[model samples]
Target chain A: MVRSKFFVSLISSLGIIALSVAWMPVPDAAAADPNTFNRLMKPPSKRNPPPTQDGIHDPGSIGTQGLQTPREAFKPLPPAQSGNYVDWVKAFDAKKIQPRFDSKDPKAKPVIMDLTIVRQVKGSMPDVIFPHKQHTEWLDCSNCHPVPFVPQKGANQMSMASIMLGESCGVCHGKVAFPVADCRRCHTETKGKATKTSAKAAAKPAKSKKK
Target chain B: MQATIHITKLRLLPVAMLLLVGSAAVRAEFGDIVLNNVSEQQGMRPVIFQHWFHRIRFQCRVCHNELKFEMRVGATQVTMDQISQGRFCGACHNGEIAWTVENCDLCHTGKPGLTTKIQGGHETKGPGIW
Candidate 1:
């Protein structure tokens, strides 16, 4: 009877130890499931604390510049689409763009530019497409900043021939930037007909433009 | 043995609660945003502040770490002489890395109580955060 009593006590103690271990707090060094941890990461409060400079996607307070910054400098010119390449480049200078916080943003909220292709200038507007992200990577805010960019829509009468002849994009396209030789680089085609036009001029422009 | 387990749990519960409260206080201490340093010169306070909003644009080396901006605000003691040297703001503001500080409107700004309109809606210049 004494031996039986001791065994019962030992078994009970072991059972109790098991229960204690089960009830103990689990260390949360890492999460078991990824999805659960994602939702769990949300701040405890429902209220979104005010936008910190580093908080939102927009580079806020950490800054802003007003029309004149409460100061004066020849009263900023009437904001307009650039009349010339220099005007366009100057406009790009005014908007100081810091490198982005989120690299994915350009791809996510992309701005699509309508392309106009022509057999030649003054011929037909050939519908060329300009990807905002593609151009933004190679350039800076000044690349298309002030009086260059009209505050409103339907501004800046940019010509394709001028751009091709080393004005705006041609500044780097034929030399440093992606060359104009690649037709499909900017245009889409049903069966590569435009490719022939692009190729014919490609080999010649590359050779003579350097001089 | 059972009593020991109960006591341990009870003790842990209060400690956990205290830790939670302590962390909340630290977050609240910072309030809204983290400002690096404030600059003052003879009662004139330019936002010598460096906020993270503009920091990540380039690297800290571009200014504080590389350009060697004094960690303390106004410590660099920027003057006309230094402006011409291409140090501090002159590093980028010298018509190269950035615009030059030659113009009165560029850095002096001439605004008495104007803040920047950047992330914080301050309408301040590029130097708001520093």
Candidate 2:
């Protein structure tokens, strides 16, 4: 009985480990479940989805004053706060323009624009204004060139699937390049529709409309 | 038998590469990019142009209006010869506006790439593998 119990415990422990990895978080490029990105990117548009806005958000986690979102309450290079990436993910900013580099290094060129990434197999890529000049400040040309980039296009199997899985641009964008969690920063629609409609209202609390 | 298989595989490799080098990567829905909608052509679609950084310098009108170029790839008809003359891309490729055309290798050297790096000064490793 003792031996069998030990074996059962071992198997159960392994099962828990696997399950936890599921929630541990997808790599920067690999992408977490879209429902999560949608929830984060799309304000609490409906009741089914949880609220991600500033005031009254995650009220269960805090009091009613409003959730302390960096993008909402804090702006301008983010105040000196003491929180992890979660704090950064929950915030949004309209003024802080996204950073990018003019890629003079041929090898650092990305495989595809985010607009056409295959959602079925590959996750959506953040439309990073990739900072080429900035990256060269630290990395070597061989790091991305020759090994990852081919001498021409379509030679590399770089897609959202590969990138998120850490193949192409995602190799760095997810791990180093400011991360892919900030949705609106990179995916800004030139023709403003949502923001023009709900700039401040997005941060306000939605009261229970009387039936 | 092993020797023959190895040689045969090696011989067919170039042909396979030729087909692959011609096509761009399968499309993605998002990222910093240039989109050119291929028009009037069947094999290659119009190039999707991305204004990732070009937007930093001149206004959209700089290229769209001042240059009188269309959004579509072939729509502008930037002949390899014309670029060398400062016509389409040549207008600025003279080391002042952009890279010099004498370095045809900059844009036209590689096999048809799905994408190309517009910036210069740093070393550029071609993105094609085929």
Candidate 3:
């Protein structure tokens, strides 16, 4: 009787152990790691994933399946590291993509303003050349004027901290535009040696400063 | 032997909890907007607006100024009727500029019962992740 009782208990215990092991959660490869959940830490290989694969779209949605992948659309466009991974300015220059200036009015033309605002930084960093040509080619004055920017000289108090926090230039730069990681792109004007763009900006009387 | 088994089960409890926490944080991307004002009440999934994709093609003023989409989350009370009538999303999604409102699943792809909020936190005030 004692031997039978021992076998019964051992079998029951083994069954319980098996059940518990089965119940234990399996580590999911797709699950976000709590330690590295920030979107900025997303792997470079995963950047600019297809609409279906990107978490933004519902993978199971029929619309997602019908949509073209970024890789497919960007195959011929110049590539970059961040945002949509396509150098939009370069792509526009190369005539690879012609984004409609106005969504409603197909014939609407963008108000292309040729101006540059040189913001002299306090440190060794080169002065930031805010080229209106590049921005105006894609955006409208109302997009930044009288709101984020006051459209007045020496009005906006910009800092790297503020920009990084998604204020001012941060509104577009780190999000849709090229990230702030490309430091030299903005800080191109060296001390006492104004680049051709900045020299032209300086030559033009501050008449268009409000713009 | 039974005591040892019980201890092993206890050790697994924390690991399971950690997995649950990790899964919860995987929902939203960088510029994703989850709009749920009237979705759950109407028995529809909340909309997940992909800002990055739209901004890729059009400038911010196209939506923020012309379309009158409020910069703040939940500020614009977008409705199906408004959309069908060619306001907000309908401005472009009228089967011409982009996809039409008939394609419900494309925009309204948020999981059931999500509240109206901008995922990845407030874009302007959130910690600089980039």
Candidate 4:
């Protein structure tokens, strides 16, 4: 009788061990990647925490600037009083907010240009209108001049793949600046006539405008 | 023999509990930093600076205060040109203290997608995990 009792207890003990092992928390799958875990331990506050409702994805933060994410990024933003990008640009122009400079130099005037050039990619999503004044408010002319883009017109070869890879406008758009998720932000030309005129202007051979 | 088995079984419970607690603490302790300033724009890989790798030997004040690195990501413009001149990371990585910039792949693993298979939880896998 004692032997049978002991046998039953042994089986129960083994079953408990098995159950505990199963209950153990599984390690993050990212932990399995060997190239990443150079050291056994890591420092705190380095990992990019999951986006919270009140985090960078907050709607108050989203405006004329690029939305952080397509889903949660758009929901939190305030309702637009004016649907037109031109009106928004006009409002900024009226305010007369000069270009921001890291260093104050009176001689270095901010380049205020009111030109909007539409770049149409045949059969792609709506053509994007390149806005100059909006960008000048935050960045210096040297930031994107001559390097990422040549001063001459149509010099930079911009594509969706390149932007996603963090090239061209993707450098600031997807990173700390703004994201390129909101297609409507750049494709503001809502009329069919404007699209055709810009398309024709671009296709005209050797009418390159010098900077 | 039965008493011995019972004691062993009782002991195992605490061990399992301790293990669960230990792992949870360790997983929460480590966090990774993604440094991408002009790297992607310049056709180079962004540097992923892991804190644990440096924390084991140095204190937080060394990099945070002494080195003048901002707590926020992308705030400090760490250019390769600056790094080569012994400014931020270049201070220690002057070939005397740590590995030099000549060993580019050690830190500049380009895009994280090309490096390691990143799982969910916003956790990424890249080079320099060693």
What is the lDDT, from 0 to 100, of the residue A138 in candidate 4?
A: 41
Model 2's lDDT to the true fold? 0.35
Q: What is the lDDT of candidate 4?
A: 0.47
Per-model DockQ: 0.06, 0.01, 0.35, 0.05
Give me the TM-scores for chain A across all models, comma-separated: 0.29, 0.30, 0.70, 0.46
Candidate 1, which segments miss by more than 4 Å at Cα? A1-211, B1-50, B109-130
> For model 3, what is the alpha-carbon lDDT of residue B39?
85
Give TM-scores for every candidate, taking all chains together and pairing residue i with residue i: 0.24, 0.27, 0.71, 0.36
How far in Å is the alpha carbon of A8 misplaced in model 1? 96
Residue range B23-68, candidate 1, lDDT tens digits: 3322110111222122223333233222322332443224544456
Candidate 2, residues B23-90: lDDT per residue as tens digits? 32222111122222222132332232223224323333345444665422234555546666667666
TM-score of the candidate numbered 2? 0.27
Question: TM-score of each model's B chain?
Answer: 0.43, 0.46, 0.76, 0.62
Q: iRMS for all predictions?
A: 20.0, 21.6, 7.0, 16.5
Please provide, for model 1 over A93-117, each residue's C-alpha lDDT reduced to its tens digit, 9 standing for 90 to 100: 3533333322323233223332223
Full candidate order by TM-score, most accurate first: 3, 4, 2, 1
Candidate closest to the true structure, highest lDDT: 3
